[model samples]
Target: MPQRTNNGFGLVRRGLAPALALAFTLALALMFMAESAQAASLSSSRADRRAARNEAKTQAEEVPLTPETFSHKLVLDGQAGSVLSFTLPEAVHKGLELTTFQDLCVFDADGTPVPFQLRAPQGTNQRLEVEKELPYFMWQPEKPGAGTPGTMDIEINAKGGIVRIKGQTDDLAKPGPVSYLLDMQAFFDAASSPVSRGGLAFADDDLRERAIKVLLAGDEPFMVSVTMKTSADLDSWTSIGRPQMLVRTRQGDVTLERDTLVLPGTAKRYLLLQFADSDVPIFSFAARAVFDKTTHEVRETIVPGTLSENKRQIGYTLPGRFPVTAIGFDLAQAEMMAVRLSGADDPEKPYAQRASGFIYRLERDGVTVTGEPFPVTQSNRYWRLSAAGDIPFAAAPGMRVYWQPRELLFLARGKGPWTLAFGRQTAVQASALPMLGQSDVQTAREIASPPTDTGATTPAVAKKEESREWVLWAVLILAVVFLSGVTVWLVRSMKK
Candidate 1:
């Protein structure tokens, strides 16, 4: 019996050895298959990503513009030889896919694309020159508590003239025509005029006209009339006729201020200002000179927004992708509230704060004063308004957005009745071409044409790619299942 058992054990051990070797061989084959499948999948994914990047890079140059690919079309009228320029209307905002209008295309009657350039509205250029915080010395009557003629002793020589005026130690406490002498020597020196050295040739034409802006700090609102005089020589002064009024008054939340006084013509080296009203109790004042010159012209468009609201804030959805210049609110009732304005290009993205200020509509004594529109230069599709505090709105206010539409300058290539096509998700961006000079271009009139919407086209290439991926996955799955089944069968046979 012992001999028979030993023979059976030897036969079992011999069978087990062959089964283990076969199982090990099968395991190695399975691992190699899995590795090959994984490597292929990774390579395919990498290739797809690289192809996508390459397509995006060249799409602007390779893709041709077609009428059927866009959702909106407008007909343009101009001669073939002339370069045409047109300002994009607010209606085009709804069909814009890119903030920079890269998706916009112009095609002639024969469907051939034309070279175009986008630009801001052309206008007469203007520049503002400001001289902030001009230096001034206060002067008062020479004799204290006595009615006497004010004496100004001036010493004049070749280099410069210096004026010495005697007055009380506390000149601000006295009540009279408070005088201030403004030294314009620095302004003359910077203007590069001979007048600074007392040669007396007029300054540059750009600095001929100037406006003085004054900021007053006082406890109460006051209105006063001022007399201005200019002098090259301290002894001989020329009076500017007519007293200008400076006023500051507040009613409720609205403050009305008029502190700027326009000068007649070119100013001299010295400026003297005399206040007429003494009972107003003037405390302190600051002044600046502003020079404005027309530089270029600007064109803008204002569009009304569709209002929306949530539990936290109110929003305005603009129809077009606009480079917002300013935001205004139309309040039906007289109300004042501090609010913050925010904007975003996409609704899914967080709104960024653009501007924050108090907006008010106040009425008093049969006059209404509305706050100026908040100035903000941003490009966005959606805007939101939130209260600075927990202030609630009784009713929804109207919103108006102001933006300067980019001008499109295109060569009138091919034939008549050119079309502007826009609004496509997969369409390639149009390259910006060199724009012709304004003098060389003719203005093109836009004819309102109903946009044709050929519904979204299905991408056959994407569908084919997806099908290929599915086939590769199925083949990998089948190989894994076959290897697993074969391994299981071998284990069962070994056991038997």
Candidate 2:
């Protein structure tokens, strides 16, 4: 009986092994099912976002050029934390080439873009990544006049936490306004001179009233103090500029001062500073002569305080160095680029960020914007607009822009702002010309011809005027005689 019981126990132990193994496999399968369900939920959320973006694209195509969306139709489509959508219209769409890679932009509430992934069209061409060769999408419109529409049938998938879209489809044939804002930043090189801010409290009290010349070395708007230190001991000086580097910013706008005249007539300088405080980055600059009045003459006097000693000063400290930037804009296109502002030979700094402000090219189909001299040198020159509803290239993010219907030319740098100004005179606004340091401005500031107390016009000028008058009289007389003869002939013919 004992032997039989032992055999039964062994049999039961062997059978239990297979049962336990089966139970363990079943538990693993259940866990996998739960994980898959969670994954599907996430995917559904993304699909919903994508669908929303597609809907926005549809609306953009349907809408026309209204005051509301004149700026751009594609502001993000969802809530504060949701995915964004934008519509790329024709004006900005000129540069998109579906042939190669994709354009990566930031999706934001306003027109600003946040970091995002631009997916390619599904079931069609595979999306190519430029990450290795170019990292980011550097906008390069085909050479002016060379811009041609790229192949249609393109879609963009904007993704950060969520995925959204904007692109061209056959139903939406007409290219709308390019609907993406760049994170643009322009600044002055704080390194060259002491990089101090001037928008609010300028270092020197006299700076506010003192006229100072500015030259941009970068796209950033910054300040520097120039002291006409005295040389009583042959090594000291005092501040000559009142409110030195006294920069004025209205809200996010920057108001600048300039003593270095580009010329006494028709032109003044304006420094562009459109950044908020506590915002710092790699600096760059551009210089301008902000005029006090529409006459293009913004001037201030910084009375040099008493120089403790007669022999205390070495020399008059020239006001702040004039920084110049070769900024360009296009009114028709409503786009602007700070192109160049560096210490290097050409001074062309082509980098950008969010703080950079925009300019408007007040234009009339190649006609000079602002009526300032648009020399042949700047034949290819253009400007951007910033007034609200005027167009994208015109308005500044901080201010409400009231546009002047006439085309215009505007200039700005990193954080350099644009304003909504009404014409103060016949040609109320003046275009800021591309200046080449003081050397170039010296010519513009100089009276075209010196004004003499003699009150007598230069002999050469007088002669030319007299000759012009005589020629005008002669032409008038000829025209009258010709008209009389023709009239007489016509009357005779009618009588016959």
User: In terms of lDDT, which candidate is strongest?
Assistant: 1
lDDT of 1 by residue, 1-496 (tens): 3455545556557676776677668767766776686677667767876776566546634656676667778888987867899887766766887677766788989998887877877764333354545666566655543322222444333655334444435546466667767666655555453222222233355454466667666647888899888887675677876789988899998888888787666568777777765555444443343333433333354444443453336777777677677888888899898889998988899999999998789998989888888988887878888878776765667786767777888888889788988776554445566655678889998765555554634222222345555676676667667766776676566556
lDDT of 2 by residue, 79-151 (tens): 2332222222222222222211131122222332233322211121111111111011111122433222221
RMSD of 2: 45.1
Among the numbered candidates, top TM-score falls to 1
lDDT of 1: 0.68
List per-candidate RMSD values in Å. Answer: 15.9, 45.1
Model 1 pairs whose backbones collide: 93-320, 123-296, 123-297, 124-295, 124-296, 124-297, 125-295, 125-296, 126-295, 126-296
Error of 2 at 140 (Å): 70
Instruction: Evaluate residue 108 in candidate 2 and report its C-alpha lDDT on the 0 to 100 scale.
Output: 28
Candidate 2 — what's its lDDT?
Answer: 0.26
How close is every model to the real structure, measured as TM-score?
Answer: 0.50, 0.19
